[model samples]
Target: MENRNRFPHPLFYLFPLYAIGLYFLVLGVINAYVFLAPISIAALMTMILLPVVRKFENWKINRFLSTFLATCLALSLYLSMFVVISLQANSIYENWDTVSGRVQNTVQKVQESISGISGVSPDKQLEILNIPPSALSSDSTNAVNSQKSEKDSTSKKGETKESTAKQNSGVKAAITNFLDFVGYSLLTFIYIFFFLFYRTKIRLSIVRFFPENQRDKTNKILNGSLSIAKQYLVGRLILIFFLWIIYSVGMAVSGIDSPILISLIAAALSLIPYVGTVIGYVIAMMMAVVSGGETGQYIGVSITYGLAQFVETYILEPFVVGDKVDLNPLVTIIVVVLGGLVWGVVGMVISIPLFGMLKILADQVTVLKPLGYFLGQDDMGSKDDDFLGAIAKKLKRMFK
Candidate 1:
C-alpha cells in the first residue's frame, strides 16, 4: 500500500516523457536554426516597425508600399553604416606599416618594463618569448632575401599554377558566401513585409488556437508581448545612438586613432548587454595601446567608460527603457549565455526580448505565474528606498 501510494501521482509517470520531449525540442531548434532564425527575426522586426507602417497607412499609403519603404529604409541605413566602416577599415589597412611599427614599439616598451621589474635582460625576455633578438630589426638585407625567395618561388611554373588555383578557389568561395548572405537577407525582408501586412490576421489565427473562453486572454498576452518587445528594442536603439556620439567624442579627445571606427564598434557591441560593455572597454584599451597613447590617454579612456556606464544605468535606461523587460540579473545572464550556446551572436542579441515575451505569457497563465515571478525583478520591499532606487526616482521625476 505504501508503494502504491508513492506512485499515485500520474505526473511521476509522465516526467521522463516530458524530459525526453524537451531534449528533442531543443535539438530540433538547434538543427533548424538556419530556417527558424529569419522567421524569428522578422517577427521582432515587425513589432519594431509596425508603428512606422501605421503612420504611413494613416497618410493614406497602401500597406504594400508602406512595408516596402520601411524595409528599404532600414536596409539603406544598415548598408550606409557598413560602407563607412569598410572605408575606415581600408584606411587602416593602407597604413598597416605605421600601425605595425606602433604595435612593435608598445611591445618593446612593455618588455623593457617587465625586464626592469623582474631582473631579466631584454635579450633573455626575447629568448623566453621564443623570439630571436634580430626579429625586431628592420635590416634591409633580410627584406631583400625574402623578396628574392618570393621571386624564385614564382619563377617555378608548377608553383605559379598552384598559387593561382588557390587564389581562384578562395575568390570563388567568397563570392558564394556573399550570394548566400544576399539570399538570406532577401528572404528575411520578405518575411518582415508579410508579417506586417497580415499582422491582424496572424493575431486572430493565434488567438483561435486557444479555447473559446481563453481566446481573449491569449490575445491580451500577445499584445502585451509585442508592446514589451517594441519598447525594449526602440529604447535600445536610442541608447546606442547616444553611446556612439559619446564614445566618438571622448575617444577623439583622448587622441585615439580611428576613433569613429572604435566608437561605432563599441556602441554596436553594447547590444549584448553586460558582457559586451566589458569587451568594448578592452577593445578600446587595446586600440589605445596600439596607438601608443600616454598615461593621460589611458586615464581618459577609463573616465569615458565610467561616465558612459553612469549615464546608461542612472539616466538613459531609467528614462527610456524602464522596466520593460523586468528580468532579474541572474535570469538575464543565464538566458544570454544559453542563447549564445544555441544560436551564437544573433541568439544572444534577441534572447532578452524573446524571454521578455515569454515572461508576459507566463504571467497571464495561472499555472505559470510562479515561473514568471522567478524570472522577474525582485520587489526589494524596504530596499526600494535604497541609494540606486532614490537616484532612479529622482531621474524619472526630473525627466518626466
Candidate 2:
C-alpha cells in the first residue's frame, strides 16, 4: 500500500520562502495602501455605504444607483458626527484660558503640599519643579526681587529662556508637520472612495490571478478577508462608543472634574491596547486633581479606571467581540506594544489588522500552517520537547 502520510509538495517550502521575500520586496509599495487612512468622515461613510449597497441589491435596485446612494448617505452621517465633535471641541477651546488657569493653580497647590511633606523649602521646590522664579510669588515686589536675583545669578539662566523659546518653536513646527499628515490622510480617503466605488472591478482583477478551476477558492478567500476587515473596523467603533458612554456616565455620576473631558480622554486612550487605560488613568487623575483641587477625587478617578478596565477586559470584550478575533493574548499585547513603540498612534491603529491578515494567510498556506499554530489563541498542544530532561529522567530510572 502507498504511504498514507504524504510529504508536502516540493513547491511548498520554496513557495513560502519566495512569498515572504516578495512581501519584503514590495513592502514599501504595500505600506502605502496598508497605512492609508480614510478621513474618519470618509471611513464612516464607507462603513455605512457598504450596508446600503447590500440592501439595494436585495431590493433589486440598479447597481450604480445603489452604490451612489450608499456613498451619499454615508457622507451625510459623517458630516453630522463631524459637526458634533467639532462643536464640542470648539466649545472647550472658547473657555481655554479660564480652564488653563484653574488647572495650573490646582496643580501648584498640590505641588506645595507635596513639597511641604518632603521637607523641601518653597524656593527649593520651585527649583526642583523647574518653574520660573517668577511663578513662586504673586506679589509684584517679590516678583521684581526674584527677577533681579535671577538676572544677577548667572548668564546660564538667560540660556534657559532661549531654550524654552526654542522648545515652543519646535512645538509650533511639529503642528505644521501634523497638518501635512492630515493632508496625506485626506489623499488616502480620496483613494478609498474610488476603491469602494469600484470594488467589483478590483475583485474581478484579483480573480484573474488563479487558474479557472481554482477561481472560486480565490474568490471565497477574497470575500472572507474583506468581511474580516469590515468586522474589525465596525466592531472597534462599537467598542469605542460603549466605552465613551460607560466612562462618561461613571465620571459624571461620581462628580469627577471635567467629566466630559475625562470621557474623551478615556475614549482616546482606549485606542491604545494593554497600557492605554493606564495612561488615561494618569491623565484623568491629573485633571481631576486640577478640576476638584482634592486628593480624594484623584484617587476616585484612578479607582474608576481600574474598574472600567476590569469590566472591559472580562465582560465587554468577550461578549461583544465573541472571540472572532482569536489572537493569542500574549501575541496581541506584544504586537500592540511594539506598534505603539514604532509609530505611536498610527501604528497602534494598524497593528491588529496587519497581524490578523498575517495569521489568516498563515492558516491558508500549507507550509505556513505551523506558523498559524504558533500564533493561535488555543494552547492546543505544541510539538516542543526537552530532550535533555527526558534523557536525564531515563538514565535515573535505569540506575534505579
lDDT of 1 by residue, 253-293 (tens): 99988899999999888888898899999999998987885
Worst ten in a row by lDDT for model 1 = 145-154
lDDT of candidate model 2 versus the reference: 0.67
Which candidate has the highest lDDT of all?
1
Instruction: Record all residue pairs in model 2 with backbone atoms less than 3 Å apart, i.e. clashing.
Output: none
Question: Which regions of candidate 2 are displaced past 4 Å?
Answer: 1-49, 76-81, 135-182, 380-400
Give the per-residue lDDT of model 2 (tens digit) for 130-231.
877666334644757566654466775677788999999999999989798567755645654665678778779889977999887677666655666567
Give candidates' CA RMSD values in order.
3.1, 11.2
* Residues forming the 10-long window of minimal summed lDDT in candidate 2: 36-45
In angstroms, give how far residue 226 of model 2 lies from its true place. Answer: 2.1
Give the whole-model CA lDDT for all candidates, comma-separated.
0.87, 0.67
TM-scores, all candidates, are 0.89, 0.72
- Model 1: colliding residue pairs: none
